[model samples]
Target: MQLLSVNLAAPHAADYTDSAGRVTGIDKRPVPHPVLVTAPGPKGTGGSGLAGDTIGDPRHHGGDDQAVYAFAREDLDAWAAELGRELPNGVFGENLTTSGFDVNSALVGERWRVGDAEDGPLLEVSCGRIPCRTFAGWLGERGWIRRFTQRAAPGAYLRVVEPGEVRAGDRVTVVSRPEHEVTVAFWFRAVTTEPELLGRMLAAGDALPEESRERALRRGA
Candidate 1:
């Protein structure tokens, strides 16, 4: 797979009605990526860690943190054709847009080498689906959340193994790690929907990232 674009936007303020019949103004700040490092700040909204809860107030749900979305390059082109316009900025709602990669099919604990194969940060991916209403707002509908989950292409959360500059048109390759079999999607289900598999993922040890391991522990609780 290759990078289609790297995007960032300045935070802007907007108002919306809530599920609880309240109205509020949301200030969505921009960052290098859509993944949030924590629950607040530019990193808080998007930069690649966890799919923050998306259906509620973003500040409360943590603003789509660590969310990565992707579409086939061809699909993007087709979508552009139908819309009779180029895909709008932030329309894909992803920090990195990729071509020729099936991100959803990636296994949890799978590590990708995101640069020259010799020296690059190992991006270990974990989890899927950070559903929220803002996502629906981005998609122009409520059911898009369901469609996202059902499709389960919730792109993986990555941790920098060697932190280096990643640019557009970079190639992504799976550096074969034979020990783990679980994909981020599998762990997402195990931790969120199935308690049984949490221990199993932890036991897989080095195959899983430390942050993911901690989340699994919380889920098992």
Candidate 2:
């Protein structure tokens, strides 16, 4: 797999999002150069892990678990065909737009080493991107949340397991895969539409976001 481009947010105003001096950072654009990747401390305190991307709303976005959002270029192409519109690399607010990667099919806790350097950034598949109203408003699509959820290709959120510089065209190597069957898509379904599947989500272990893990735990209990 390859990193097609590294994208950063282009701040823009939106009514469906937080208005307390916070404009939506849902509009992301691809960066031409390499960018440093790091963990953004925690969920609410810090924003995007990329050097200069904006988060707009920290209360519900960012942090280590949701640090770097990635979407497959193929998925974008499929959406473009379905919507009959052009969707750019970062149109979905994904930090990394990947080609030849089945992001949704990635198992939780799977690790990827990116770039040519042996010390290149290492990222772990943490969870699936959860659609919010800000996302729906940004897309301007009717029933986008329902549409996206129904498609079940929510992309993937990654945690920076090893901090390093990453650039477009970087080779993405799957360094490790957990011995679990919980892919990102399955996890999304389990949490959002299939409560019965929540019992199976525990197989993913702590790789899931704390809230999701806890929710699954409570359900299984």
Best model number under TM-score:
2
Candidate 2 lDDT for residue 38 = 93
**Candidate 1 ranges with C-alpha deviation above 4 Å:** 16-90, 117-120, 191-221
Candidate 1: worst 10 consecutive residues by lDDT?
A: 22-31
With a 3 Å backbone cut-off (N, CA, C), the pairs that clash in candidate 2 are none
Residue 40 of model 2 has an lDDT of 92
lDDT per residue as tens, model 2, 170-217: 999998999988999999999888889998999988788899989998
Error of 2 at 129 (Å): 0.7
TM per prediction: 0.61, 0.97
lDDT of 2: 0.92
Q: What TM value does model 2 have?
A: 0.97
Q: Cα RMSD (Å) per model?
A: 6.8, 1.0
* Model 1 per-residue lDDT tens digits across residues 29-72: 22343332222223334333223313234434322223333334
